[model samples]
Each structure stands twice: as structure tokens, then as C-alpha cells.
Target: MLGALAQAVERLPPARRWLVGLSGGLDSVVLLHGLAQLGGRVGSPGLRAVHVHHGLHARADAWAQHCQVLCDALEVPLDVVRVDARPHRGQSPEAAARHARYQALADQMAPGDALLTAHHRRDQAETLLLQLLRGAGPAGLSAMPRWQPHGSGWHGRPLLDMDRPMLEAHARENGLVWVEDDSNGDLGLDRNLLRHEVMPRLRQRWPSLDTTLARAAGLQAEAQELLAERAREDLQTLRGEAAGTLSIPAIRALRRPRQRNALREWWREKGLPAPNQNRLEALLQQIRDVGPDSGLLVTWPGAEVRGYRDSLHAMAPLPLLDPASVWSWDGIRDLALPELGITLSAQEMLRLHGLEPALLEPPLTVRLRRGGETCRLRGQTRILKKLFQEAGIPPWERDRIPLIHAGDRLAVVWGLWCCDLPAGAGRR
Candidate 1:
């Protein structure tokens, strides 16, 4: 087991540090032990361990203590992160815990660090079965990759090719003890049901089920790569005037299957959640109904797609903002606009062109456009709406753009047009 693990560690890309995800469970404990043995020989890259305290189980604190002790014995630095793992509406408990755990671990990684998990062949097979039951497409069926770039660093599974029995044998030979999460026996959870009941029955008939399913997942991964490559090629031709927007007519030119493939790939590239088949089909139907300059919005959890003026724009669901809301700015301190997810700084404004020195004075009012506002740009007094149209700013964004006011006349529009000031006017 040590020899196989050493070879696997050698295959990992060079990194400034390696973070082992120590859950205090059998699999993780064995993985950390093996890595500790290889530390002196493998040019040990700042070996350390992190354990996420999900606080979901009764023994969650105990688990953290166990991980600390184990890391201490191995002379490894350990970080225990506490996270809120409570499930949100429509989200399963398992999913919430997993999300929280990974998020906590990811926070501990730096640019050149890699987080290793002890996911073996059985885990891969179980993931494939779950994806299959969910009727997922090629990308989902591919299961987890051995390693992938995540956050500022990378995430890897070094024990991906090994079986659970192999890890158990190594643990026994080395006198290793581990904490067993009681939740694993709960049949209510889908993964537990599959592992404790369904898999054993299936394995009775097919002893090599894990290897077979893992192979199938590998093939699906290959298919996903090809699809992603094609999508990248198609996107270059279908790009719209705006960044991340797709040309509607170009998409319409493709056949239905290819359109679906390209759309999924586009979502992947944007790091947005993939739309289910029904949602994708509905979006396509709505696209066909859209006329030039007319628009429609399709929404699902975590993301939304909007068709506007011959383009499809995908993004996180837009936050609601009241156009009548107002904020006073001192023009000295940074102003926080939580609703807009941005901060406005007077210093940043001073670095830009077309701003009157008086615009940066005290008593400035900041608000969204309430319509009928006009500004002078290039010696022409134009309505804000017309200016937005000329600038190709979408209607949904017009109301969200921050308008800085000096008593009723517009002084500046954040990130867009600034009112033209006469030479030497309001200069300090």
C-alpha cells in the first residue's frame, strides 16, 4: 500500500504545500498515515492536514480532537475549521454538510497548495450510481476527477485507484484507529442506502462491480472532454458584443442536440450550475419565441439566463434593488452599497476623467436611476435612457447603475458616463 501510495504521490503536480483532508475516519486516517511515511523521501512539500468541523453530528468536536492528535503524532501542522452545515430550503442534509466541509477546507488553501482526499474506487462507483439515478448527462456521470484546479490551489484524490479493502488492510497492519460516523448506517441517506444495502447485493453477483463502474466513469469523462472542446470552438464564433454573452442567431443556427451541448458547456465555462434537461428545453423554446430587441428570462436555482437584443446572457440571479432607494455619500470615506455588491470610493472617482472637482465635495447623494434624469456628455444634454441605449447597456442594468448627484444635476455614473465639466469649473 505504501509503494502504491508513493507512486501516486509522485504523479501529483508540484505544489508549494500539500493539505490532507483528515476526517478522522478510516479512509482519511490511512491516507494521512501513508503520506506521513513518505514525507522524508518525497521532498516533503510543507505537509499539513485540515479537518472541517461540520457541527452536524454529536461527535463532531471529538472528531476534530482525533484529527489533531493524529496529526500531532505524525508531526504535521493541523487546522480545524468550524462551519455552519445547516441545510437550506430544498437542500438535503448530506449536500449541505458536504458543501460546508469542502468550503471550509478550500479556505485553508493558498495558491500553490493541493488538498488531498481519500476517495477510493468504491467511492467513485457509488458516485456514478448516484449520478445515474439522477439521470445526469455525461459531465455528471463522469464522477469526480482525480485532480482538478479549485479556488486558488487544487483538489486531488490520491487513493482513487485503490479499493477500500486495501486501505483497511494497511490500517490494520499499522495499528491505526479511526472514528466511525454513526450516520453511515442510516439508510435514509441515498449514499448510505446504496453502500450498506444495494451494493453488497449487487457485488454478490458481480465481485468486480467497483472496477467496472469506475471504468465506465472514465469513459464518460473522455466524452465530456470532447464535448467541452467542441463547445469552446463554437463559443468563439457565437460570442456577443458583451463579455460572456452568446449570440442568439448563431445559437439558433445549430441543431437541437448540438445547441444543448453547447449551452451546457457554456454554463460550465462560466462556473454556473448546469440547467436540467427540461429547463434547457424550455429556454430553447423561449429563445425561438423571442423577436429582435425583445427579451425573456429563464430562471433556475443558482443561475438565470436572459435573452436580450440578439444575445443570451447567463449570470447569477440578479439581486432586487428599489430604484427609489437613496444613500448619502460624504465623498471622503468609502461608501458601501450592499445591494449592488460593490463599494464606491471617492478616491477611485478622482482618478477618472470628466468629474468636476466640486463633485468630490461633501453632501453628495447616491441613488439608482428613477428615470427622467439627463446628463451633459460631449456638449450634448441627453436623457439617461438614450445614453444607456447608445452604450449598449441592457435595460436590467440601467436601474442598477449608481448615479452620483450634485444637487439634482447628475455628476457621474459609476463605471459608465461622467457629466462633462467645463474647463476650470469648480476647480479647487
Candidate 2:
């Protein structure tokens, strides 16, 4: 096990820092000791131990102290962080605790640092079973990966191929003392239920249950990769103009199964959570049945999908705009619009002014117009709605399109028509 860990460390990009998560449990204690013993062989990445006190159990502080003592004996720097792990309504206490603990550890990581955890084959088998029972798709059934990016650093599960028994044996061989959580015996949590009830029975019949499940998870991961590749190819056909958005017409052209697969693939590509089957179905229905003029929006916790003309836009929730006010702009300098993540530079504004002299009036501002606003085109004033239709700018883009205004008078409709031109040039 230690040899495999040494090889894993050697394969990683050489770094001067490594943060090991020490839970003072048999698995983590063995991991810390193995790394300490293999220090010279692994090229010494300035190893340090981090213990997160979830504060859920009464013995949390003592467990943290034990980790600190072990780290001190191993001559590795130790840091202990306290995190609130109170469960929210409808959430499992174990899951909430783990989430809080990992979040706290992620906060401590720096760039190029690796967060090493002692997840083994047993844990992998349990995870796979839990996900399978939840009726998860390929991505979820793939279980935890060996390595993944987390914040500024990477998370490494070097002991993933090793079993719990191997880690316990190593700890016993080294005469290491570790605490066993009482909650591990509880069968209320899904993983615990699988471990205490289902797995024990399966292992009794097939002794290699853990090994088999781990292998199954690897196969699922490979299948997921193939599906993702196919999804990427399909996404090329559904590409839209804006980032993170998809073309509604193109999406509607796909069969229902392919559409759901494409949506799932898109979310996975963006590292966002996949919507439930019901939500995804509803989204597809809205795209197909909603009137072209009606605004359609479907939102989840971290993302949203909206239909705009022929495009289906998926993004973070639309920010609430202060529609009652307009930003003051001076012709002398560029205005930085942080809300839009865009800068209205002086050069662009000057270029606009040079194109249309009528746009130079005082109190000139940039703002979105309410529906039914009108502007004069050439010799006659026309409703902006008709002007957009004539210009061929789709109805959906009208709300997002920027209009240059001079106090109460509308100047030029950018990229469409100019109220006036430079001295000698005639309007088209």
C-alpha cells in the first residue's frame, strides 16, 4: 500500500506543499504514518496535516487533539480548523458534517497544494452502492474520482485501491492508536446502511464484493467518458451565440432521449449539477410549447434556463436590474459597468458620437428601454418595436440591446440606424 502511495506521489507534478487530511481514524492514521515513512522516497513535499473539527460529536475536539499529537510525533506541521456541521432541514447529519468539513479543508488549500484524503476501496464500494440505490445515472455511479480540482488546489485519493483491512493492519503493525466513531455502526445513513446491512450480507456470499463493486465503478466511469464525448459532438450542432446558452431550434430538432442526454452532457461539461429528470422534462416542454412572444424561465439552485426567440439560454439567475434609474455618463471618460462585466470605453463612445452628431447632447446615458419606446428614424419618428422588426434584430435581443440616449431624446440605435451621420456622409 505504501509503495503504491509513493508511486502516486512521484507521478504527481513536483510540488513543495502537500496537505494531508488527518481524521485520527484508522484509515487516516495509517495514511499519515505511511506518508511519513515514505517521506524520503516520495521526495518530501513539505508535508503537513490538517484536521477539521466538525463539532458534531462530543469527541470532536479530542479527535483533533489526537491528530495534532500524531502529527507532532511524525514531525509534520498540523493545523486544526473548527467548522459548524449542523444539519439543515431534510438533510442527513452525516452528509452535512462531511460537507462542512470538506468546505473548511478546501478553504485552507493554496495553489499547487494537494489535499490528500484516505479514501480506500471499501469506501469506494460503499459509495457505488449508495449511488446505485439512489438510481443515479452514469456520472453519479462513477463515484469519487482519484484526483480532482478543488478550489486553488487538487484533491488526491491515493489510497483508493487499498482496502480498510489493509489500512487497519498497517496501523496495528505500527502500534498506532486511533479513535473509532460510534456513528459508523449506525444504519440510518445510506452509506452506513449499505456497510452494516447490505455489504456484510453480500460479502458473506461473495467475499470479493468490495473488489467487484470498485471494478464496476471504474467501468461506469469509462462509459461516462464515452457518453460525454458523444454529447460534446452533439453540442456542436446545438451551439448558440452567447456563452453557456444553447439554440432552442437546434435542441428541439434532437429526439427526446438525445435532448436529455445533451442537456446532461452540457451541465457536466460546465461542472454544474445535473437537473432531475422531471425538471429537465419540464424545461424541454417549455421550450417546445411556450409561445415565441412569451418569456419562459426555469431555474434551479445554481443555474437557470430561459427561452429567448430561437435560443435557449442557460445561465446563473438573471440579476435584478435597477430599471428605475440610468447611469450618468460623461463624454470625457469611459464608464466601467461592473454589473455587466463590460467596460463602456471612451473610444467606443467617441466613435459612436463621430458617426452621429445628434448623439452628443448633454446628460447622455446608456440604459435599457421599456417596451413600447419609440425613436425617430431618418425623417419620421417610429415605434422602436417596428424599427426592430425592420432592422431584423430579433425580438428577444431587443431587451438586451443597448440604446444611446441624449437626456429625454433618443439619439442613435447602435448597430442598427443612426439619427445623423458625420458632416458629409448621407444616412443609408
Candidate 3:
């Protein structure tokens, strides 16, 4: 195990920092010990251990103290991160703890640091089976990747290829002690039930069940990579004017499976979860049924997809904007519209659209556009609604855009349009 870990760690980029998530479990304990044995190696990455205190178990403090003692003996710095693991409505306690735990670990990591975990072949097998039971696609079935970007840095599981028995053997040979979480045998948790009950029975019938499952996971991961590569190719061909959005026509032209794959990749790149089956169906239905003048948005937990005119947009769930809310702003100063999820500032305008300082009108009030607003563009006065429609601006965005009034005269539309101000600042 030590030899394998050494080779694995050395294969990583040298002269970077690394931190191990020390849970004080047998797996993590063995991981830390092996890394300690490789003391000051070329790719050691200034080793450190961090213990996350989920505050769920009664023995949580004891586990943290044990981690500290081990780190002290190993002569490595330790950080104990305490987090509230209270489950949200309809969420499992186990999942909530896990979410809080990773966020805490992410907070401790710097840009170039890698957070190491002790997930092994058995864990990979278990993860694959769980995902399979949930009827997951290739992406989910490709479980427990060897490495992935975690928070600001990266996450690596160097022991993923090693067996659980190897880690146990190394721990016993080194006389290492670890805290056994009493909840390990709790059948209420699906993973625990599989580990304690289901796995043993399967292993009895097929002695190499874990190994076979792990190999299947590897194959799925390779297949997933190919799918991602194809998605990338399709995206390049279908790229839109904006970042992280797709040309709707190009997407519609592809076969259904390609459409789904491209959309999943697009959402993933935008840092949003892939839409579930129902949401994806809803999204496809919208695209197919949308009229020439219609705009539609389909949303699911943590993500949304919207189509307007020629483009399809995927992003994190947008904030609920109340069109009734209005704000007074001096065009010279920055205006932060928290409820609308936008900051109307001089720099943003200047950097993005070259808003001249000469247009810095004092006492310029900002408000959401109500119906019946009018502005003269070019020569004739045009209704704001008609103008937005003519410009092909999506209906959902119209009310959220800030309208700038230069002392009761409608002067500039924050993002969409600008009238010629007295200072000639809005001409561009």
C-alpha cells in the first residue's frame, strides 16, 4: 500500500500543497501514515491533515482529538473544522453532513492545494452499485473518480486502486489505532446496509465481486470521457454569441440523444447540476413547442434552462425579481440591486459598454420599467414594451433591467438601450 501510494503521489505535479481529510477512520488513518512515511518526498506537497467535525455523533470531539494526536505524532499541522450538519427539509441527515463536510474542507483549501481522501476499490464498487440501483447514466455510474476539481483546488483519491484489505493490513502492521464510527452497522443508511449485509452475501457467491464492479466502473468512466469529448465537439459546432449558452437551432438539429448529452455538458460547464429526466423532458418540450415570438424557461432544483430567440441559456437558478421594487440612484455612484441580482455600477458599464464619465449625471433615479413607459429613440417616441419586443429582448429580462431617469426624463436602459443624454453620454 505504501509503495503504491508513493508512486501515485509522485506521479502528481510536484511543488504543490496537499491536505488529507483525516476522519480518524481506518482508511484515512492508513492514508495519513503512508504519506508520513514518504516524508519530504519530491511530490509530497507540504503535507497537512484536516479533520471536519460534523457535530453529528456524540463522539465527534473524541474523533477530532484523536486526529490531532495522530497529526502531532506525525509532526504535521492539523486543522479542525467545525460545521453544523442539520438536515434541511426532506433531506437525509447523512447527505446534509456530507454537504457540510465538503464545504468546510473546500473552505480550508487554497487555490493549488489538493484535498486527498481514502476512498478505495470497495468504496468505488459500492458507489457504482448505488448509482446503478438509482438507474443512473454513464456519468453517475463512473463513480468516485481518481481526481476531480474540488472547490478552489483539486481532490485526489490516491488509494482508489488499492483494496480495503490492503489498507487494513498496512494499519495493523504499523500498529495504528482508529476510531470506529458506531453508526457503521446502522441499516437505516442505504450504504451501510449494502456494506454490512448485501456485499458479504454477494462476495460469498462471487469472491471477486468488488474487483469486477470496480473494473466495470473504470469502463464506464472511459465511456463517459468519450461522451464528454463528443459533447465538446458538438458544443463547438453549436456555440452561441454568449458564454455557456447554446444556439437553439443547432441543438434542435441534433438527434435527441445528442441534444440531451450536449445540454448536460453545457449545464455542467456552467457549474449547475444536470437536469433530471422530468426537467429534461420539460426543457425539450419547451424548445420543440416554442413559437417564433415566445420565450420559455424550464427549471429544476439548483438549475434552469431558458430559450429566447436564437439561444438556449443554462445557469444557476435566477433570483426572483419583483418588478414592483424600485430604487433611486445617482448615475455617478454604483447601484447594487440585491433583489434583482445585479450591480449597476460605473465601472461595469464602462468596462462592458464604454459608459463615459461625462454621462455621470447626478440624482439619476433607477427603477424597474412599469407598463406605459416611453422613450424617443432616433426620432419618434416608442413604447418601452414595443421597443423591447422589436429588439427581441426576452420578456423575463425586461422588468428586471434597471431604467435610469435623468431628473424625470427617461435617459438610459441600464443594459438594453441608452437614450441620448443632455451630456451626449448615452450616444454610444
User: The CA-based lDDT of model 3 is what?
Assistant: 0.84
Model 3: per-residue Cα lDDT at residue 69: 94
lDDT of 2 at 32: 87
Query: Tens-digit lDDT track for model 1 on 152-270?
Result: 79998999999999999999999998999998899998999999999999999999999999999999999999988888888888898889899999998988888888888889888
The global C-alpha lDDT for each of the candidates, from Candidate 1 onward, is 0.88, 0.78, 0.84
The digit string of per-residue lDDT tens for model 2 on 239-297 reads 88766678888888989978888999888767666777778888989888887557777
Count of clashing residue pairs in every prediction:
0, 0, 0
Most TM-score-accurate candidate: 1
TM-score of 2: 0.77
Model 3's TM-score against the true structure = 0.90
Q: Write one digit per residue (lDDT tens) for candidate 3, span 24-99.
A: 9999999998998987654476889999999888999999999999999999899999999999987789888998
> Model 3, stretches more than 4 Å misplaced?
13-15, 41-43, 330-333, 346-363, 420-428
Best by lDDT: 1
TM-score of each: 0.96, 0.77, 0.90
Candidate 2, 102: how far from true, in Å?
Answer: 3.3
